[model samples]
Target: MYNALMGTAATTAVGAGLTLYYLEKNSAHANMEAEGLHPADYPFPQKKLFGTFDHASIRRGFQVFKEVCSACHSLDLVHWRNLVDVAYTEDEVREMAEEFEYTDGPDDKGEMFERPGKLTDPIPRPYANEEAARAANAGALPPDLSLITKARHGGVDYIYALLTGYCDPPAGVEVREGLNYNPYFPGGAIAMAQNIFDGVVEYEDGTPNTASQIAKDVVTFLNWAAEPELDDRKKIGAKALLLFSSLTLMALWIKRNRWHTLKSRKIAFNSPKNWNKKPNPPSKN
Candidate 1:
């Protein structure tokens, strides 16, 4: 009895302690009701159920990423070869890959060497490591944007808002030093300042290089980066849907037309009434 009572008391104490700890953590995190604003529901044409990414926008987004975001953020998951025929041609990717030198293996003399970046190599990192990245960015690590669209809650829309939402903090809002105000971000302060602006990048397609346009294109590119096979996936999904629908209809028709009689027919069982007496009568006849 004592052991059971002690166990019960211990469990209750642990539960109470956990509850208190969670409550304190929640209070710390939920200081303000305004955690962040919902991202704008911009009607991206490529986000359509059966739609594809805009390749032109993807190219522009690549341009934006290279010229702007690449300075701090690294696209570690992507390879130079992956961009070929998706955003840029093979020749272009080859040329772009050649622009960055990569560290190669030691020679016969046991010396490391530098070689041009190959298409197969992962995209160059901005910093050598996390420590260096943090040191450069005032101890704030710039996140790799390879899968950022899928990693975040609101996906690309959230990113777009974040990119364009930087502004002066409202009254009573105190953004600390080294932080910038963006209502779209949780806690309303982010390490990444407003990077996009009007004419920040010149679009080869002649799209006006407004801040919003830049944000949109980059967001699109990030989304594509997150899911490079989106177009192929959509195509496969449509084909699969059609195939399954046809199979389902065919199955229903076969059940209705071919197996209709077998499925619908009812069997009646008759009890032998005069069998015993009939056998005796037949023998007499």
Candidate 2:
């Protein structure tokens, strides 16, 4: 009776616990449904297992960044030299770097000097400091675009969604005057307004300047900025897989051939008397 009672009590407790868990989970999910929408699952080609980035799109993206995003957002981590081979040729990168002036070290006269930017210099910040950045944008400091994709929750997809997801608020929803409506953002409102629009930036390569295209290109560029080693990393991973796969096959073949002989070999004990019988007889004689 004691054991039976204990078992029944445990079963009841377990059932009650499971019931509470199910109720809470369902409630949370329903709340989310009422709150806002998740980011769309964009079909980014470079996200594939073996897919590579479209360099043309990346180049166009760089152009978009310079003309549009550069005004507010900063690309502090990426250097001008990184553009070489990936988006721009060496000479083009050199010229582009020279366009931006950089502050140099103190001269022999003990005064700082300004000089043309070099390939080694990092992308410059638009605002001199965080306070200035916030003051300009109504207390919103623009995040650096260096690793924006990796830093965000849904990565590139989330950013792209936020850029293009601006729309009128849903019924019964009241947005603040300054904040813009973006369902992809938390609480369905964001400080930064929708910036990307049709014909925001022109592409030298003759790509269409549509809003979607511009956002796609810029996101691709930022993704590349976040992970510049992506191409080389993928190539190395493929080569390693190929090399190890070939070696694995060779090993299995050798193992099967050699181990077959070992596993199938016979072992028998010989009677000592057979080899020693004649010697014993001679010794007795």
RMSD of 1: 9.9
Best-performing candidate as measured by lDDT: 1
Local distance difference test scores for all models: 0.89, 0.88
Candidate 2: residue 125 lDDT (0-100) = 82
lDDT of 2: 0.88
TM-score per model over all chains: 0.82, 0.84
How many clashes in each structure?
Answer: 0, 0
- Give Cα distance to truth, residue 122, candidate 1, Å: 1.5
As a TM-score, model 2 comes out at: 0.84
lDDT of the structure predicted as candidate 1: 0.89
Give the distance in Å from residue 239's predicted Cα in candidate 1 to where it truly belongs: 0.9
